[model samples]
Target: MKKYLLLLLIGSSFLTACAQDQFQRTSKGTMYKNFTNNTGDRIKVGDIVTINAIQKTDKDSILYSSYKGAPIKVQVQAEGDMMDVLPLLTLKDSAMIKVPTDSLFKDPHAQRPAFFPKGSSLIILLHVEKIQSLQEAMAEREADAAKKQADEVTLVDKYVADHKLTVITTASGLKYKVVQAGIKPKPIAGDSVYVNYVGHTLEGKIFDTSYEQVAKSAGLQQIGREYEPLKFVLGQQGIIPGWQEGILLLNEGSKATLIIPSKLAYGDKAAGPDIPPYSTLVFDIELVKVVRSKAAAPAAATKKPAAKRTTKKKTTTKKTTVATKKQQ
Candidate 1:
């Protein structure tokens, strides 16, 4: 009985080693070893898969690790060489794929990374976390964008409350409080206004200013052009929606502070290297002057009426007629 049991244990160990050594290769020269069974639901095309992956060169130098941050979300397709392995994965599946570097940089227009040398292998360790339909993924993205906007709004509301600011909130989400109510002649929608302003983030970092002294002080001056008030047409889209709406609320020479939301400013997209996405902006604007657009003159003021056609009554020619008859 002891001899029979020993032989059976040896056979089981051999089978286990064979199972662990099993690996598959795709036609494109991708070698993948699946550590998990594929008995669960499989990933399909058009499905959005969320994965945490760590990529490395053949030398084992780490290129990227999504485990350090958010998992990468991708739509499965059989086209891209890198994405070919995605269709073979299921939720909670883990695998390691060795892809030829040349295959990825095959396109002449593609730029290869400098760190990855030619003829080396690209190692990928992927873990598929979740799977969802394309429609579901799109819906989730929209919900996330909306939630971010809501959070921004809440933040602005908190700032307003904390400061005990008395501001006028417009229908379009612009908040303003007039500082110096300048002379009459409030700007209207069609006016061209020149404003000296300083724009900053909520943290009070000045990004832009129209005044020379302020620009010099902030070290943001532009060479060759003298600093002066920025002139723009009111209600025009030439500037941001917030500036257009807020400038019209003040009169000539008026000074006010505008608290603008991201929707009215850059809106989820970063403006530049300085401004991040979904940032609320603040501006201390002084309305230098509000001049009406040249074309804004009243139509009737330049119109000319048609000249009246006058008719003179025929004069009596009796004296002349009699003189001609007498001479005849």
Candidate 2:
């Protein structure tokens, strides 16, 4: 029985080796096929290469493609065993790699796309286009970022001038234009206020809002989360600093536009995947209602008793009139 078990194990190992020999494989079990053998300069560590990559699933559902725009520049580094193929590619070389989804993402807790099913596979077709030094890539990216920042500043200034807005600039560099006046009682610290707001980028792309229609139009509606005004305490750290400062200036029922610069907004850190770093934001806000302090709230609650008493008196008169008619 021991001899037969040893023979069975040897036969299985032989068949596995034969199957692996059919494709170029990484030590971690990822398989690849080289489509072209261009004798161009091979990739090396510390080299930044521009490559056109298309990622798809076994069902041919394309997840990402670089054909629409410029190829992505990637630095060849040892991120994982599957990434070891990056140094084996030459300029103008093309290859397709098949990777097990579970093996690629070994961490069970890692977040994945909703479309990517477990125990499935991914196919990546990559073509190396060009190569550059690490220093060159960094310098180019920095230059592009600086140019983008300058252009954004110019655009914001032009919009302010074209609209002819009479905006009030705060000491902290926040610009606000009040469209409509509100009641005399303005909100103060520790007061709870309900606000309706639409937040957008400088380019007029709406990111978020408290309006159902706006969210629906933007294709950002969440299931079962009905849209309504947001309520928070004023002058607390419950919200962003720009919101705290801007909302305090408006009274109840006021409508205003707050133009917040990067420093007063998210600054150099990104708020989410959609909001880039150093982005300027705009908010159209309406102060809905303000809840008074605890001491004043009791007084407001006391007035409700008088209102209830008046309603009771009216009901009693109607009942008496009906009884008198019945007797007649």
Candidate 3:
């Protein structure tokens, strides 16, 4: 029985060697046709290559290809097998590599299949584009950061100039702003502010609002319905910092113009499609009402109600404290 098992193993090994020989090139004075990856140059282990190749069957039908920008950078790990065609690429040399799907990913605790497709197989055709060095990658990232800062500054300047936005501090205190006398009112920290705001881009494109939010929550999607007042707790991070800070300046019925810097708006990331990357915002905000919550004042005091009568004369002092420090 052991002799029979040894013979079976030897036969299987011979068949595996024969199957591998199909992928090799033979040279009898170049008479045999050699299947070279005629697309790009050979790839190496450490080179980061971009591929726009597709998988297909033995009859050559394509499955997928990169349709967007330049090719992607494939980072090679320090250990394990790094695909089959790593030995066939050079720097800036583009080539196609066919990788088996079973060899792509491996997980032990998975359900259903063992390998990628059980008895089936798949292929990944790759093209070696360019190799990225650590220094080169860092430098490129730093350059992008610098460009973003310059853009944000430029956008802020343009917004301020075009909108004629003013930033005058007010005697009413409480994050003050002056817009058409008595039109804007000061709000306390704990007030629930209902604001009708239209946020616009540099080209006067409104991207978001409270009306849109209510309509969206109600399953309505029309643009006209998206223009409504949104109610939120003041000083909370529910909206951007610009919105929070700007709204705190308005009295219960104030209409104010707020020109926000990109840092205060979306920070580093781009907002909605209308708000481009590194964009400054202009908001025309109208304060609807200051929601007076019964529990808003007692959040920090924690004193007895009968003792509160002794501090009745200090109501304005308590309101001032709520305006400044806040409970947080």
The candidate with the higher TM-score, 1 or 3, is: 1
State the lDDT of candidate 3 residue by residue for 65-128, as single tens digits: 4533345556554443334444544554332223344454455454533334544444334444
Best by lDDT: 1
- Judged by whole-model lDDT over C-alpha atoms, candidate 1 comes out at 0.79
In model 3, where is the ten-residue run with the lowest total lDDT? 25-34
Error of 3 at 45 (Å): 8.4
Hey, what RMSD does candidate 2 come out at?
A: 17.1
Q: How high is each candidate's TM-score?
A: 0.69, 0.61, 0.56
lDDT for 186 (candidate 1): 83
TM-score top scorer = 1
Which residue runs of candidate 3 sit more than 4 Å off their true CA positions?
A: 1-66, 69-90, 97-125, 128-130, 163-185, 211-227, 293-328
Candidate 2 — which pairs collide? none
Name the weakest run of 10 consecutive residues (lDDT summed) in model 2.
Answer: 319-328
> After best superposition, candidate 3 residue 183: deviation in angstroms?
5.2
lDDT of 2 by residue, 44-102 (tens): 88899898777777566667777655578878887654367767778887777777787
